[model samples]
Target chain A: MSPKTLYDKIWDAHVVHEDTDGTCLLYIDRHLVHEVTSPQAFEGLRMAGRKVRAPEKTIAVPDHNVPTTAGRENPDNMTEDSRIQVAALDKNAKEFGIHYYPVTDVRQGIVHIVGPEQGWTLPGMTVVCGDSHTATHGAFGALAHGIGTSEVEHVLATQTLIQKKSKNMKVEITGKLLPGVTAKDIVLRIIAETGTAGGTGYVIEYCGEAIRDLSMEGRMTICNMAIEGGARAGLIAPDETTFEYVKGRPHAPKGAQWEAALNWWKTLYSDDDAHFDKVLTIEGESIEPTVTWGTSPEDALPISALVPAPEDFKGGKVDAVRRSLDYMGLTPGQKLSDIEVDTVFIGSCTNGRIEDLRAAAAVLKGKKVKDGMRAMVVPGSGLVRAQAEEEGLADIFKEAGFEWRLAGCSMCLAMNPDQLAENERCASTSNRNFEGRQGYKGRTHLVSPAMAAAAAITGKLTDVREMM
Target chain B: MDKFEKLTGIAAPLPLVNIDTDMIIPKQFLKTIKRSGLGVNLFDEMRYDRQGNEIEDFVLNKPQYRETEILVAGDNFGCGSSREHAPWALKDFGIKAVISTSFADIFFNNCFKNGILPIVLPQEAVDTLMKDAEKGSNARMVVDLEEQTVTTSDGESFSFEVDPFKKHCLLNGLDDIGLSLEKVSSIDSYEEKASQARPWV
Candidate 1:
């Protein structure tokens, strides 16, 4: 067992009780729901004759299925397939008495992004959502993770969840990150080294020089994919970066309470003698801009690497590799740089933050997108969109052949009208590379925002280093 | 239904990885917030043909595994998008326990709230269970939810542990809000003190 880190301290504080079986019943401080998963849970409550257990603690938003196009006359005019889905979420949230920030809400955005911007996500809270990106909230020094629909129902009715304690894993990234290597690159490098399932059965606490140097948005991006590497959640100790990010948010504490909150947050770090079940260290400068070439996040490679051949895998893993290759329509031993893309999407809870937009805009500056490639840039939040426009980044995107759209989850899962045609390949900034994750039979290559922008200009999988 | 005294039955074998929520229940079915009707459409894409007929080759359609109550799955068993429908469909389809080498954090937590026990076992333990599940459809396993132990038909027993707090709540069927309400009196007292000290609200 490790000495209490901030994560352990928070866990102990929130623990209602422990069972003989070692499972803990945790009280969720905040519950964020979206259209996709909340409806069924609400239905389960209705079936059991139960009202929402604590409506005030729960906030709902329509993100995954919301359209990114600025304004549409009606739901019917929204030609995207996910429009109907968003409307359904709208109706369901209303009937359940949950506070739903609809698309019309100036605050509307991806659920993970919306939670933090609205000050609904706070430090020392246990937050859960029906989206894996729920881990994004953990950057604020909270114990946040994603949940499923059945659990959603349970929380709706009970406002608590049963969970087993996870082993502690500390991944210390030392040294300064090299230029052109962002937090996305660092996480991708970790995934590449550890494989996707490396952090399973553990909550990973990131520390050391490189991690502490990242901005709050950058830390959020790192924590967001704790799930991608099979970790329960990823977190960073709250510091000046965290405090500065939360300073003037709508729900953040004010005045004396604010000072008290900062004092408490500053205490959120691992003790010097704290031990972890596992510890892995990596040099930040060694990481490069990365992209996924296979069907899983782990099947990623540096932009300069060739597509892996089936023979590259050991033993029975070759079959899965072959299957992924077949689904992706990539030839064995092909140069990854030669892979052409038809669409470029630079938004999602994963990379919709203002910093992500700016990173992409920086690469798009003075470069025109390929003649036939379709590109769209959706901001993560209204504030992010407004800030980008104020900074003149939106105009750069528009001039570079990218559609500057309203803040929403756009082309992340093809839940909205934005989708790839059958067999089309896209450079997407969203997490996940499962077959048809963007649409029916649509192939996707997961990349960073800069990589997505670089690919948009080159119309292929080009190394972002060249543009940077 | 009788207090869910003990969880017992065969654990089905599913070797697939990264089984996402969308695959468990498609996006089209998300229109209604209701959870009851989703079980039938669970794994619709894999279970059905292009014409919507049940695919004979699908794992669930296999005769021997039809009545399985426990699912022994592969690594990252619940990955990709987070749709709670995955667990709902699994529960409604009669799965009570999911034993795997690993599980996505969200899906793992979701299992407990729905009365589904998601067990994380070492690869060796999972391999043994997978073989046991593959032997026959009627293979029986006993899971004492109270004891936190899983026993196979051959009398092999594995002692597992859950958080004591969650155990009490599950045993009493209490949730977070319920637990908080249990302490309402104390909260009210604190509120009264703060109000008196401030005299403003």
Candidate 2:
């Protein structure tokens, strides 16, 4: 047999039919829907008089619109549109005979976190969601990507998608990451090198020693922001770390089924001689606890570097630099360490996992948040929150002057009340630094959980390494 | 969905690069499931001020471009998020087509399903259309899907490419899901084989 990339092997296996125009019908294994995007897709299905072809294969998760505060028990008290969107999901799930985990349910969380926790996401399967962070499931080697709600409806009516193949690119990381550097830093560094639009029309497969050294949660942080780099999807070949995480989960195969699954999954990696369209390599030792100074993910630089001037750019780059600097309200030669922030947000699907909290808690231990600075730590899932409490991480956060909130995508995109003030600078662990992402006119600087803790302690964008 | 053959209407010019979906529709306005009401809030942060007054300085709110029927944007328009609402808001605002130097892959695909034609042209061609669009409401442009061409009112024509399958669906107003379901038998057989070979999955 010819050597094939991991993507090619999975894609070829799922092709239902190939059309002459280089498009094919690919069978979908699982469909994950959230509150904000699924309502309209459900409406489209009803308008067409079409019932879901495979309700058993779909899971409805209502996370994006739910309130993270304690008073969320009464959905009516929520904002009008938010209540309507969430209530619509409950009704749609009942009408469509699909599984749903509402905010009241213990299982409810960010779709990306809950899907894998419940074992609904498996290796070698194709996963589709209406949210861009659907790529988070690619940590298990699934061919996962975000789709429009129109495609959501299409998938609901038929358990397949009319997808065209994408080019395959590999990013190889060599050497070992420095102690303070993390999975988020590596992905941020890659995005900075590749730029925001670099991965267009391609699937990025993260490989090599540094990638293999990370845990399943760490790998997920890398895959979650592949869309920020403009990649269609990000993948990491499943290995022992992936298998161990899936072994005893609720939906994972039980008893003898596990043996059979692992036996097949062992062959899911790419062969040494597999051909790739493009391969970019990075030295992991060069990575630092990175931070974004501008509005885009690709606008990151190491803490040691100063904000780059627009004049330092070439090829008509001044426009982008000037716009980002103008919006972020940063000077051209400003150093990241000299920047002070009004708030620190340590949550998001990107860094709200238990491991992320552990990293942050390690820095916050025996320390107090700076005076007049507000900080919050919101876990990604109810499950992660429980694990954090079990480890006493929640108490550590509270003692350190960081507000501990219930689980959701709180302060990530700030759909709920957890938001930054007008013109307030924030050190956030969430993915994007797009202008006003957290709130109206709120300036955000993206960092890792450890760095967010360091920023809180110092009231500025301080390096986590020296603090540690 | 609306069928696309040709269109002639005023084109709005937005020359900013990486016009992400969040910019088109902020998270605050993403609450409603309905697509129609979003037009009023299109470009919510950019089009409106903190107190909800229209920011007249923004291009879309200008008197001449308020009723824009087509959009001539910069490179990588709709560059972030996979929200179909971006196209929904565009269609709700009476935009029949969007012309850009290039588009993010997910957004480009979403436009077709929502009856918005996304045209990809070279930078030089886009610059020409953008200049023509600056002429305000009088500079109406034409997009002919049948010919795969976009023409400015000034007699400049630029040919483009479209996927034959997407083109067929748009022209006939055919069901994309129905066409995909035509291979139900093949899908069932493959599933049967897969389940048998890998029963644990």
Candidate 3:
């Protein structure tokens, strides 16, 4: 057989059936569900009179709409819509015989983080969820991507999804990263290099010296925003780091089974002669702590840069730049680091892990959040929150005037009480910086956790290196 | 699902790049379990002011474009989030088709599943249709899936490519789950083999 990429090897292994037109029925090894997207899917299943094909392989959690406040036990305090959605998930999970993590469950948190923490998202598996950030699981070498509600219902009924193979694109990051630079910066830089739609029809496999050196958490941060760069999925080959991360979690294979899985996972890399449709290389040492200055993730620039003028862009982009500047209330030549923020949010599927919390805590140590600026730290999952408390990271945040909250997708998308008022500017550690993503008329500037911490201290988009 | 062989309707022109899903239907509207009733909130922020009044200048709010069944939008339409609510809102608003230079992969797929045909044309063709669509309610555009062509009111025509399988499914208004059930035996055998090979999963 010809040489195969890591994606090819995984895709071939999961094919249940194929058509002459290159369409394949890919078997899904794991399905992660959340409240917001699963309600309609469960309704669709009921309307069709179907049963969940593999309930054991499916897991449900309510993250997007649950309030991150301390008093979340009483559903009455939640907005009517939020209350209904969470209740619907509770009903659906029980009816479908799916494993569910309720708001009170310590295991409950963002589905993306919870899946990996539980060892349910393993290497070489085809994982899927209804949220676009499902690409977060690809860090484990799983062929994971987001699916629509229709696909969600279909998967519930048939453990299979219809898919066409995407062209393979190789993104190589060479050299060592700068001290303050992080996985989030590398990904933001990648999106800035490849415009928003550059990876539209391909799956990017990130590889090279820098990529190999990242922890599984860091790799996940890079893959989490593959959707922002317009790729449905991004992948990294499974190595020792991947195996070590998966070793003793609840769902991981034990003893002999673990040894067998490890042996197979060792072979999950791309062959030397594997063909790639496109290749892009970035010098890791060149990346700085990056942040988005516009509504799109592609509007990222180094913290040392200035707000770009519309004239700095050309053709159709000029109008977009102008619109973004107007919406962000930014002047053309303003320094990025000088812009003040009304809020600082430090958590999400993107940077809610223990490593991210530690990064932020290190920056906040012995420092206080700027006066009058509201800041909060929401861990990615309940377990992550517990670990942070055990590590005493939570106390550091609280002492610094940051509200350390329970785990969920707090202000990332703001379906809960953690929302921005109209025109409130926030420096966040979430994925998308799209208009109104954090709240109504909320302005979001995406950054890494440490950068968010720096912003909290300075009340602006500050460079972490400066704080260091 | 509904069969979409052809559609001839008033087209609304929205030429903004990166029209993200959050713009199509905001997160606040996603709490519902039903797919219907979202049309009222389609482009909710752009369509209405903070006080809940319609922004008259927004194309869809204009009288001529009120009943638009097709959209001539900018590149990378539906560019963020896999809400699937984006397509649901568009379909609920009675948008039968959309023409663009490019589309994000997940949005393009969701469009088909929701009976919305997202047509990809060259920049020139889109420019022509965009200008033609600006002519208001009297101007009409036709999309024929069988013929694989989009014709403007002025008789200009352009052909577009679509996957044969997706085209077939759209033509028949097929239920994907029902179709997959046809091969249950194959799925069972594959699962059995996979389990034997890797029982830990």
Interface CA RMSD of each prediction in angstroms: 4.8, 1.5, 0.9
Q: Estimated TM-score per prediction?
A: 0.87, 0.98, 0.99
Docking class of 3: high
Question: Which candidate should be chosen as best, given lDDT against the real structure?
Answer: 3
Please provide, for model 1 over A109-164, each residue's C-alpha lDDT reduced to its tens digit, 9 standing for 90 to 100: 88889888878777777888877778899888888888777667767766677667
lDDT of 1 by residue, B165-195 (tens): 6556556665554455465454445445634
For model 3, residues B1-201, the per-residue Cα lDDT tens digits are: 789868999999998889999999999899888888999999999999998999999999999999999999988899888999999999999999999999998899999898899999999999999999999899999999999999999999999999998898899998888888898898999999999878899
TM-score: which candidate is best?
3
Clash pairs, candidate 3, are none
What tens-digit string does per-residue lDDT give for candidate 2 at A1-468?
989889898898788889888999998888998899899889989997999988988999778778887778698768888889988999999999998888878788899999999999989889999989999999999999999998999899888899999998999999899999999999999999987778888999999999999999999999999999888999999999999999899888888888888877888988889888988899999998899998888899998789999888753246777888988889978898998998999988899889999999999999999999999998888899889999999999999999887778878888877888888999999998887788988899999999999999999999999986
lDDT by residue for model 3 over A208-244, one digit each (tens)?
8899999999999999999999987999999989999
Query: TM-score-based ranking, best first?
Result: 3, 2, 1
Candidate 1's displacement at residue B86, Å, is 0.8
In candidate 3, stretches whose alpha carbon ends up further than 4 angstroms from where it belongs are none
